[model samples]
Target: MLAIRLVTAPERPDALVLPIRPTGNAEGDGPRATLESSLPAVADELLAEAAALVPAARATGRAGEVHVHLRPGRTPGRLLLAGVGEADERGWRAAGAALARSAADETHVTVAVPGGAPAASVRGLVEGLLLASYRFRLRAADEAPTLTGVDVVVTDPAAYDEAVEAAVVTARMTRLARDLTNTPSSVKNPQWFAEQVEAAAAGEPDLHLRVRQPDELAAEGFGGILAVGGGSASGPRLVELDWRPVGARTHVVLVGKGITFDTGGISIKPRDAMKLMRKDMAGAAAVVAATLGAAALRLPVRVTTLTPLAENMVSGSAFRPGDVVRHYGGVTSETTNSDAEGRLVLADALAYAVADLKPDLLIDLATLTGANAIALGTRTGALYSENDQLAADLLAAIDAAGEAAWRMPLPADYVQYLRSDIADLYSAPTQGAGSVVAALYLREFTGDLRQRWLHVDMSAPSWAERDDAELSRGATGWGVRGLLRWLATLA
Candidate 1:
């Protein structure tokens, strides 16, 4: 974690980041002059030097554009002109990410905050700065350099205190999700994942945890979970974390697919696809992390997070294709494709949540299908729900949290694809709209609460192909921020 301090003025830090707005937004002649007037007299020369480099670097003060100026003997020796387009939250977030990446070597840095910056913009900047600096590596000696601290130079630090604190909590929780997702399968089995959740819930006020083992799962009739985890020696786990605050008005239940390692079970995947199966439980990581974030923030809403953990591996005991397994709510599902195991485990949890938790809003996150990636690409998550208002609220939360999610349809026509003669539902429907059919299958488990459910198929967005704004090279921790934001709105 990087240390962020809000300071009224710069104290000659190692690096100084200046927020540069678009051409028309800057005051006092131009961007450089405007920044110069805001800073002390010692920064005049450095600002001029940085301004000259901006055009050479082709930086038009657009978001995510950064121009660096290094002065050997000058005060605040290094300067970074980070673009905050239109001085908006999204713009500030992009600029913060760019700065974090560009100043990776700096130990301590200072940022000259834009004048009259709103709380949202401040929050976005802090989140982007911290999230972009996230790194996960398994190596000896740990020789790589990292950003240590940041000083946000502001006119009135008190005004943005709450915003900064909230940003820190959100970023830390998102990074927790990233850490869990990036861990290797060798060390991260279902039992280990459950233990991690239990450890995280420790010492947190009003947060309760329950971990159900294989025998308990079998006794309670979790056929889907047992069938899926029976192949792995480590077995399966159902982790339930509940945070009930005083006077909470709404109950939101979150279910995540926690396949710690997916070898595609009896139906094996290609070598290329199996390599990244360690991150198949990214959805579980997000929900667990978001639940912790809510507890840390002490949001006035009851949140129950359920993660069904398993390792879909190949073995003699692995559930075979054409096998019909009963879910928690007694909904039978025929295993058409063992690779579609996420929806199966998710069905058990969603059914249990609907039958028992009785939440006002139900949301499930999963890396369920490849078709989601094909439809929305790697940056955006495919959101499916029948409820219009819930969809609208979640979309708004995603926008506010600077995450990308597009609402997909739950077409009644496509529901036919999930029909199975031998079972209540087909695990994987061999139809086009693979993502839609996957969502429809999960909806069957929601019982009468289907209208209150929102399904997030985040297979692609869960893992990043490359580093970008607020995202590292591996697990992106996609849904945590948006889910936290949505919880805040409900609170």
Candidate 2:
């Protein structure tokens, strides 16, 4: 719950954060100049102290290095030097994140924005602070060294007004997603997930939300979701969230796989394998959080989200191997492995979204396969697109937002593994390239599978596995920033 504001020179801070550039970087000079003027006026003494205290520069401004000076009189407490090796958007955010982490014990701080910084870079800086300030202590509010507020000192306040606003929405949504994802599955099942989305949309004028229950899904021929969620006591839900500004020019539909818990259903995972299943719904969480954020920011694009919420569990009534389910659009699919249930639920949502919503571009996010993780690892995500331009656009979004993602081939030849003798398609392939085959399976149920569609196989489950990347050790809210930036680029 960090509060951030763009300000002038009047605000006194607990600590002053200055971005440090490497010796050889061209952009390092301005920041160095700003630091010199902001600090005490003894240059020779300061340089001696810095040489001893700061980390050795490996490259020209290596990222994530921190140097601290205690009780610099110009500031209230200490001076924090954060590294931004080359001063790109990614580096700026890394600097901000690094600064936030260095000042984690402090409640309030002021950061100096370098002279002649771009407005977009300022937004990234703010986002870094806000995101790094996140903690997952839902009940331990008193124990955590949480950041309460931040003041960003900028040379051009007028240029950053809108950028700050966007940062606010992005940061708030990122926290919201983390809060939802960090909550255990005991309290965050499919029904509860749907209710949460409904509650969030309560008073927003530009946002509309609807939740469809198990019976409704069955009646509507969404057998994939219905079957996958049949074993859970909590049942399943299809949560539709739509955000429409009055004069929006384009439509974007987002579908997220909301597998509340992945026990591998009847195909049951080993005890060790089932540990992190609570985070399996992160894709759906991203969609819910991002769409609500769009309404708050009032972006001039119509965004719709179809989140299929379900719990893949084991029971006498659970869907079994070789069971045929009739998905939306009247397409029948056979379940070869119940563990591969994410694609099943996504199948129904994707078809429903594209056919009924008729969006300009269709995107679905799912922690759908382990093969994707094997292909790309936990630090990066896998993105598959049938259209070349859409792939390129999403890659640009990944770079600008500083979220890691790599394009994976959908290779039409991989479609053969999904062929079924009993049904139109099979949920899991018989053999290799499981990630690619999973994407091919989802594309089969989508309307216009080869055009205007993008699929993000977030196999890493959208939570932080390490202490780096300015993210705390919980749900990273990976898609919120990139989706917002991509939506803003529309028109």
Candidate 3:
């Protein structure tokens, strides 16, 4: 865990981190100048050394670049140079993450927070730091002790304090999502996930949480979730998280697809590909974290997160292809491919959210379709909504959060893609339009809602193959930042 606080300056910290702007980008001014003015002797040595390095050796002040030095007589002894390419949210966050990675061996560090930028930038920096520092080594043979108690030096106290708290909350929740996603499905099943959430909300006064097991779910006619989880021994669970504050004008409900371990059900994924299936629950983890985050930050919006959890394994009892299951709201969906199970589980939760909860706005995130990755690649997520304004708002949030998202159209004629002779809806057209058809299928359940709905496909971004920029090796926590920004925009 990361322990961060705002302080005037470092009192001999283990490391002194300075956010370095390129010679031109800094306009020859900023924190580096401030540090130089504070200690010209140290500045003389640092500049000379920086200048002596070859192009390949120079830290360049580009995003993801770092230069470390051990200054024998300097104030902090160890000095770190963090590159800030453009000083934007992405740059700042990446630089902060790079710096945090550099701090792995050291516990106490003094970080010079960027000045003059808005609170959003400050928040972004802290978000990166925590995300980079996150490591799920619980199952590792040996784990390194991590950094704790960061001493932040900032120009403005009030802005720093306000941004820091929200940033800290968002960062922790994001890391929580990453942790939940990175965990192997063998140890982290649906029941364990609920127990963790229950533990987290144990003492939080504003949060009300309920985890509905199989018997209760079957009693309530949650056939989709019940069927998708019918194969695994772990069974199925519907995790409902709520944060309701009186006098709230706006209400938002988030539905997430939670397949704890998907062997593609009766269809069955290849053995080699199932290794990363543990991250299929990234959407559920994200929505849960975002809901808890909103409650922690005390946002004025009333939020509810419905996560339909399950393990889609192949068994004699597993739901099979060509089977028709009636979901919540009496919406029957034909399972054309058992691999298309994510949308099946999501259908029940979305219907329940709309029919029973009736929120003003509804958003669902899922690792729903491989076509999403084919269409948008690993760096970008795909979002679909018939409501123009809501789509625009969420895209703006994606931009503001320095994440990637592209809005895909909901063709008026696309309903034909999901036509099913056996049921009200089929999973897909079977060949092309996997992403589009999945969203269109969800539109069936959300048809009667009084307000707008947005569906996000996180199939690619949530489980990336390699580390890039701010995202670590696994469980990038793709939706948390953008969703948080979107919620705050509504607030």
Candidate 4:
């Protein structure tokens, strides 16, 4: 974990200065200097020189850049010149990201942005940068270097401290979620995964943690979970984390599909596609991470997280496509495709949560289908919900968080696609409405307890190479912020 610190502008001495010089233009009229003049003064000559060189540092045409300056007899050990491109919020954010990346390997670093920068905008920029530079290195043998501490110097210390503190906490939670998602299945199987959740909730007075192993799952009539996980040597487990604020007004139930690794079972997936199956549990990671963040922030409502953790692998004892499995709530499903198993595990978890915990709202997340990726591409997840208001709230939350999500209709007619000849329903529909079918299948398990429920299909956006402001190349923690924001708005 990185250590963060904030330094006030008055603390920096006058001996340090950042002279901004514009690049791509002639002598006296450079945009860099024009922008720099709008910022607070630096404390050292070397810092001033580096600040002046930012405009000419790079020609990416995107935003600002940062230059490092080290000078003797200065108040601090090193100085950073941050470019304020066009003096806009986006420019400041970009510059902050660049600075964060530059200092990722350092123990401590200071960012000197102009005091005139908006308190909200500066905090947003810093938060965005920290999010973009996060990576999961748990599987690596060598210790990866990371930024330990950051000091953001601002002119109006009292004005920006609250917002900055909020941003820092949010950023830390987002990174924690990303780290869990980015960890490979080899190190994060069902048992280990549940252990991590336990550790996160160890000392929280308001939070309670419980784990259901294979035997306990069977004892509790979680047939769907048992059926899907019976094939893997690693087995299956259910994790339930609850945080209840005293006399809370509203309760939110979150369900995540924790497939530690997926080999596609009998209806196997192609080799190329199977390589990324380690991220199959990204949705679960998001839910756990969001729960931890919400609890840490001490949200006013009660929150419960139910994760069905398992591994989908091929073996002699693995469940087959034609197997008929009984589920919680006395519902039975015939497995049409073993690859479409996330929904099965989630069905049991969701049923247990809705029937047992009885929250006001339920939100289930899974990387359940590739058809969702085909529809939304690699940037957005597909959203389906019975409650229109809940759907709208989630969409607005995603928009505010700057993540992509498209609301999908739950056509009542699609229920016919999942009808099984021998059993009550089929796990996967013969018709090609893959994502919708998966959601519909889970809806059956919810029974008559129809609280506001949402199903997010995050198959495509889990991993990709496209660059963005708040996300990097792989294992994007897409739902962390949106979930947090939504929880913040609940009754």
- TM-score top scorer: 1
Which has the greatest lDDT?
Answer: 1
| Residue range 256-362, candidate 3, lDDT tens digits | 98999889988888988787999989999999999888888888899999999999998889999999999987889888888999988999998898878989999
Model 3: CA > 4 A from native: 23-59, 114-117
lDDT of 1 at 336: 93
Error of 4 at 117 (Å): 4.5
**Which window of 10 residues has the lowest lDDT sum in candidate 1?**
28-37
Q: What are the per-residue Cα lDDT tens digits for candidate 1 across 279-330? A: 9999999999999999999999999999999999899999999999999978
- Given candidate 1, what's the lDDT at residue 221? 88
Q: Considering summed lDDT, which 10 consecutive residues are worst modelled in model 3?
A: 32-41
Compose the digit string of candidate 4's lDDT tens values, residues 1-491: 45545666534332222323345454445452433554454535544455454555542234545565565665555555555455454565566566666555556666555666677666666776677667655454856566656666667777887766666767787777677777877787899899889888899989998899899888889998887788887879999988888888898889988999999988888999898888889888888988888887778889899999989888888889999988877778899989988988988888787778887888988888999988889889999888888899999987666578999978899989888889999999878888887888888877655547889998888776754656766788778878987888873
Deviating ranges (above 4 Å) for candidate 2: 25-60, 72-76, 138-146
Q: Which segments of candidate 1 are over 4 A away from where they belong?
A: 24-58
Give the worst 10-residue stretch by lDDT in candidate 2. Answer: 33-42
Pairs of residues at least 3 apart in sequence or in different chains that clash in candidate 2 = 22-61, 61-85
For candidate 2, write residues 1-491 as lDDT tens digits: 67777776527656766666665434543322113233332234544544444443332355666676786455446767777666676877887788778888877887777666778777777788878877776574558566678888876688899888988788899888878888899898998898889888899988988899888998888999999999888899999999989998899999998999999999999998798888889899898898998888878899999999999999988999899999998999989999999999999999998778888899998888888778887767899997889988887887788888899888867788788999999899778888889899998977664499999988584878766666889788878777877887784
Q: C-alpha displacement of 216 in model 4, angstroms?
A: 1.9
- C-alpha lDDT score of every prediction, in listed order: 0.88, 0.81, 0.81, 0.75
**Reference-based lDDT, residue 99, model 2:** 75
